[model samples]
Target: MPDRSSPETRAVLRAAVPPARRLLPVVLLGVASAGSSIALLAASAWLIARAAEQPPILYLSLGVVGVRAFALGRATFRYLERLTGHDAAFRQLASIRSGIYERMLPSAPDGLGMLRRGDLLARFTSDVDDLQFVTLRAVQPFVSAAIVLVAAVAGLAFLAPGSSLGVLACLVVGIGAAVLAERIAADRGARRLAPLRGDLQSAVVEHVTSLETLVAFDAAERSRTRIADLGERLARATRAQAASAGAAAAVMSALGGIAVLASIAGGLPQLASGRLDGPAFAVLCLVPLAIAEVAAAVPVAVAAWRTARVSAERIATAVPAEPPSGVVRPPAAAVAFPSGAGAPTLALRGVRAAWPETGTPSGPVLDGVDLDLAPGERVLLRGPSGTGKTTLAHVLVRFLDYGGSYRIDGVEAAELDPAEVRRRIGLVEQRPWLFDEDLRQNLLFARDTASDDELLAVLDRVGLGEWARERGGLYAPVGERGVLVSGGQAQRIALARAMLADFPVVVLDEPTANVDPDTAGRLLDDLLDAAGERTVLLIMHSVEVPAGVDRVVELTGRG
Candidate 1:
């Protein structure tokens, strides 16, 4: 059995059920359809038996009309059941996906980035679909089956009291078998099927996305073989579920058959004694079959519940809980850097930090780092790749935590509010993101009410002023991720955003990463000129720090 109190289990159950008011009509329609089906079959038997004795046409007319009405009612109600049920399911699934996405946003490119791309895709696509089945197939079917069962038994009780007891006996046994089957298979369903499906998804996605790399490296056959192995495991899990479903169906059938035969056996004596009529016996026999049809849904619901619960766990793991709301934000006010002695120094003493790997501290990515950026100082921090240069930049903006003392204007770094700290220190990291929006909207992220003159001035600093003027000035589309612009232009646009922020401390990580030496030199000069007296930590490689009014510090392995 699933741990009913587990958070994933609770979430899965809650998402699958929706509100009772919304699902009531769906369940009631299902019950109506099942009742009509039972009535139609029973009426057919009554008309056949009564007509065999040559009853008058007038007497048989009611039975014939009942068969017609029940038949049409069955079809209409079944259609309504499907239509109503699917509408609710769609609405519920949309809400579920939206909630997951909203929770995922705050943790983006951090907690969410830990999952492989394939696993993430599977959760949003296949796993979400599996959860949808819980509402549409699992929960709906069970509720419908229950209501119909109660109505069917009540009808039999009015027809033949003695046979009603037999019918009830049959139902209990049939439903009991289904419940037992579910209990036996629940754990296996969760333990085996979910992981296999996720692995298969990851394998196929990895192979497809990396096909070019595999072929170039001559590992195409190897990737194909690995995919086949994952496929085999998935197949096994599917077969196991199918087997369990088949067994549950078989058990329900066996108990149902026994119940029907028992009802008939018990009815023969009533018939012999003239206590039950021919039509009543036929109705009694048919009632068990109708109830069995509803009872059979139990095992399928079990499987769907298992699938959805596993999906819930995966989704919960992928998106961390949102941080508490109503944060005490400091009042927005201009920060005046202390300008007298030492010029608002940002000092670090024996700073050590590491990027976390799997919830544990990784090998020191930043070690024994000591640095200071006094106000109006433009420091060029030169380093080789993977030497924690960008990591250190992350540290400066409070994006990461560091050991030892870090002070800005004589205040502990950790003691300050993170949001205000970030506002005071701006960043133009390597490969900055640009949405598919016009240039004005992009600049608004840095300053919401920046005037036209201010925007144009910064754009001109990045040498994109003429480009902007030619393309509708501040309203040109930059396409997705600025794809319409050249690589150098994208970098320049990012630099413009940082310049517009006008923070006291600014960090530029590889601002010239995509430019030629001549272009890079020119861009650096433009940036430094625009920067003016702001304290800047510029991380660059290969190119010399061009005539900057600042000193260059080259990192050597440590920190």
Candidate 2:
């Protein structure tokens, strides 16, 4: 575990704070609201005491107006405070989430393999959301309470100095004791709750994703039991936290009563000596109750601080300060891609690379690999499992950095920007992802300006035109992860996207892996024909070579 006050954690926490301009209004409104509350209580106390003396109706009329005005101000200011405070907090949350996402991108795909999907989702969604409390529960309340407490004490001092000092002393002691008691009772539970909640969420996500496998293996009941156990632990921790907060509130209430008694005792002498009027003494005794209400925010603010600190630490841990070893980072100064005509030639000699790994390097997954493809040529790359064929594909697209010479049209690939290299070469993975959207949406992302007719033409080239029309043209849903389409149809859809992208070179890695042998042959033929004049590097394992390929290369596992 890292320190909660680490620089990374501090940076994350700082990002949660809204700018001073936006936050100033929220603080001002909070102060006005809390001040109105204290004033409301004092005015009501004075009004009642003054009425008991049978004063002129004129004096009572002013007190009546004061009471109504303070009451209305309290409610109105509170409403404005809540509105502005939440607005600023939510806007800051958007900025923080965007910053976190930007940080995650430099180490994505390969470097983030260490994080589980479910736990990562929790960090992004739940942990980031907790940061809003920095403004809502901690900073705003703490500022408002401090300002109101000082004003209340000053007003009391004007009426009865002795009672004022007593109230101030009681407030300090009561707040300190209440915060100490809450920490003692709930500190451990508060610290454990964030991680416990993440664990339970991860378990639930894993169970749901693997429900079919669990049912097939007769382990579904066991998984259910594990989820139940995690849920129970989370519930227990939540209850403990609530109990501690309750204890703190109880302490504050008792202290409020004690302050009232102390004020009354101190004010009696002044009242008897004609130093203080009856209404003044009443104000002194009763104002402590309102001040205590303001001071109650202290314990709640402390608790919010604890939770926010934990959440910030978790966010920092999830997104590392630097990209992991073997992950490629963009160069500080990169050259433009070389100008070329038609398709560009790709050549690789003595290229060695490895996937990202934590700690010490485990040597290269691909070593001493040599290959080349001329413009407008088609090549088939064959290898058994674990031979790094897919690794070679990743290297070509600049997804992973490599050691030796890989050139595009006579220029070193490393000198060019990664984004520039990707524009020239595209890859369709072994398991191509289709968005849970209609056909046009899925294809439009590759080339957003492409018309429906162009999309349909590309679909026709990939042999999905008739099949797409039968399913209601381009409006039919692909379902989540392409569940609505057969494996062969999914491959065709991916190929259609590649065509829309219009890359000079495309690498197809195991496109026929999911389809049966009968469909695989025809699918390969259709894909190759659609590729036409573009350079193609087709990666497969133990599949018959489709016709019209210009060359064949094989990778031995030794590399």
Candidate 3:
């Protein structure tokens, strides 16, 4: 078992199982299919016995025909049953994936950032695939197995009440064997499998993302060695599960064989004495074996459950659910900074935030820093590296947590809905993100409804109108992460996105770092001209401050 004492693991279990209420129909269908299959098997034995006896030729042919129909009917129902169960599994997996992504949005950046890209990729893909298989196969097989066991008992009871007791005893033995197999194999299997999956994913992701680095460093062999290790771990887990399942199957089959042998030995005398029919006696023997076959499948299914539970728990713990409905408010607003001391547009006071892995400290990244600005005020934040300039911007946006108060427009920032809070601030990070889509779509990311004229106007404002026109206008594809465009073009396109946001405040960080000197100069000129009606807080590293009557706050000192 996992260390459920960890709050993160507990949270994951809670989230994964919450929406699992939809699994009821899947259970019902599985039971119905298994029960029908058992019934058809028993009917086939009876029909076969009647055909062997010297009955009318037509009657024997009819019995053969009936067996064929029964087999076909069982196949049809089995297909439908599996289809319904798998469909639910897929939907639940999607919900779990979505939940994990939502949780990552608000998690500690340091903690989240520490995770390997390959591990997360494995979780979203193969781990998710395992979940679908587990939910559909694990629970359904047990459910269907139970139904088969119960129906077989009922059939035996109707044909020969005394024999039903022996069959029930076999089921009891099978259940115990299945439980033992699950207990012995699950934890070890999960331990081996989880890391194996994560490593495999990490290896592939590392190779792809660091292809340039790898080739530059001449380290392809090292990567291949690591992948081989991961494969070995996966093979070990597979072998362990297979061995446990083989043991369980052996035990269940032995018990079932004993039950069938005992029934035949005890009932044949009764049949010879005319107390039981040969046909009914034959069914009693065959039905128990059929139930045993299904019971044998249970051990494999249980082993899968181990892997599934681990996957579910991992996803649940990593993803954050929607917090309770009411908005949470911090106690007080930050002190207004000396610059533009009017009603503060954004403020932070006595704030501290850190990872759970790191104990809460008196000094956070923001470190109780106080800042304030008025509407339409252009403030440049110039700080030495590692002084939490970016962290402060995130705190202002409420993307990160802090100890004291952060507020917008005098109201505590926490009081406002996160979605509503974001609407007021337009942010640009150092790296400009462009999609594989057309230039127009990348620019109008959150505002798809913007008309072509509206999009062109914003591009013009960011000094990209002529650039777009040169590339066949807005419809030109930028390729993935704007690979088709130059670094300067990518930045301009990002600036166009921020400009079109039309929020009252624009926060841009190191926008010119990636651009050429001429493009950077032109971009600065256009941005200053377009800054006519908005508050622009720029965290600048290189580009000189636009010549304007605005205050500059220099952040210095270190931890």
Candidate 4:
């Protein structure tokens, strides 16, 4: 569990608060809305009691008008309050999510392995959303209610001091009781709700994504049982929180009745002594009911605070305050990438690196790796499994930081911005991710300005053009994770995407890892041929190295 006072948690909570300018209208409107409700009730009470005396019609005109005005004001202000409040909250939610995403970028892919896909989804989508309540349900309502409560009590004080004191005392006691009930009944449940919800969501995602494997292994029923068990836990927690909220509302309702009784009892003596008129006494008795309604927001606000705090803590835990070890952090003033080249020369000497999750360099995956790629050269990098071929690929793209010297065009790669380095050198992972969209949409993301003819041409270059035409041009669906395509075809599409990107140097990491043995040789040849003079670092393991132009280097996994 993350401490609520941790800097990361505090930062996340702060992001939930919209700018004062944006939130001010919400607060002001809420104050007006709650104030109108109180005034409307008071005005109605006065009008009804004063009418019983058979006063002239003209004498009742002011009271009737006051009632109408307050009623209209209440509805109008309430509508504006909701609109502004929700607007501010939604804007703040966007800011909070953007901040979290910006922080995650430095540790994405490798460093974020600790976050499972379902858990990450819950944190990013669900937990971040809960922070919005900090404004909507908690701060806005609490501030507005407090102001209205104070003003209502003060107005009563001027009318009948005794009744005012009684109402004030009842309010204090009632609010205290409500808050106490909420804390006792719901605090634990509110705190547990976020994590439990996240757990359940994660289990559902895992079960759905792995349903095929579960059924194949005869464990689908078991998985379903686990999901059911998680859902039950979440439901129980939700019920406990709901019950607590109901208890608080019940306390406030009981307080309202007690307040009305206290007002009547205190006002009766004044009524008989002629100090208080019938209209004033009626106002005293009826106002507390409206005030009690406004006061109901207090316990609910407390609950919202608890829930938001837990969500903030979870967000802080999900995205680290700082990037972990071995994760690349952009320099404060990064040097620009060396410009002017068909393909820049790449050189590395004594380079060492580790995955970000390792948290230290003591167990480096790639140690003392020395390799060089001349301009427009095609090099084959061969190694057995676990020889750090993929690690080297990641380093070349600046996904993971490296030690020692790595230079591009004789300029130190570390000094250049990682984004700039990535623009120059692209990586096609062994398993490329294809969005579940038509083929054109997938290729367009690489270079959005590419024409349809250009896309077809690149597809042809990577041996996917004829296949794409058969499927239906660029409109064919790739399915989620490219499940609709074969392993070899997926690789070809990935290469097509790279070709469209037009990186100066491309790192192909185990491109044939997923294809059958007989097809691997042909796929490798087509991929290299598609390179057409761009520097290529082809990483291969278990597959035989095809005849290449420049050179072949093998990593022995020895420092």
lDDT of each: 0.76, 0.88, 0.68, 0.89
lDDT of 1 at 157: 73
The digit string of per-residue lDDT tens for model 4 on 1-559 reads 1334777778887889888998889999999999999999999999999999999999999999999999999999999999999999999999888887888888887888777778878999999889989999988999889998999989988988777788889999999999899889988888889888888889999998898999999999998899899889889999999999999999999999999888788788889999999899999989989989999998888888888888999998887778888888888899877877689999999998988776554688988999999988888888888888899999999989999899999999889999999888999999999999999999999999999999999999998988999999999999998889998898888888888888989999898989988999899889999988889998887545686647889898743
Which regions of candidate 2 deviate over 4 angstroms? 1-4, 358-362
The TM-score obtained by model 3 is 0.82
All candidates: TM-score: 0.76, 0.96, 0.82, 0.95
Residues 246-333, model 3: lDDT tens digits? 7776787787787787557656766878988867787877777777766775766666667676776556543334322111223254
- In order of listing, the candidates' clash counts read 0, 0, 4, 0
CA-only RMSD, every prediction: 5.7, 2.2, 5.0, 2.2
Ranking by TM-score: 2, 4, 3, 1
Kindly list the per-residue Cα lDDT of model 1 for residues 1-559, writing each as its tens digit: 2546467557755875668898989888988888888788788878888788797799999999999999999999999989988888878878878877877654443334456767777777777767777777777787777777777777777766666788788777667777677557555755667666777788888898678899999999999998899888777777767777777788888877777887787778889899888877776676677667777776777667777777777766655464222122233553544344423678998886655333343556778888989888989898888888877887787766678888888877767666667777888878888889999998888888899999998899778899999999999999977778876788788878887877777898898887776788787787788777788888886546578757888876857
lDDT of 1: 0.76
* Pairs with backbone N, CA or C atoms under 3 Å apart (clashes), candidate 1: none
As for lDDT, the candidate ahead, 2 or 4, is 4
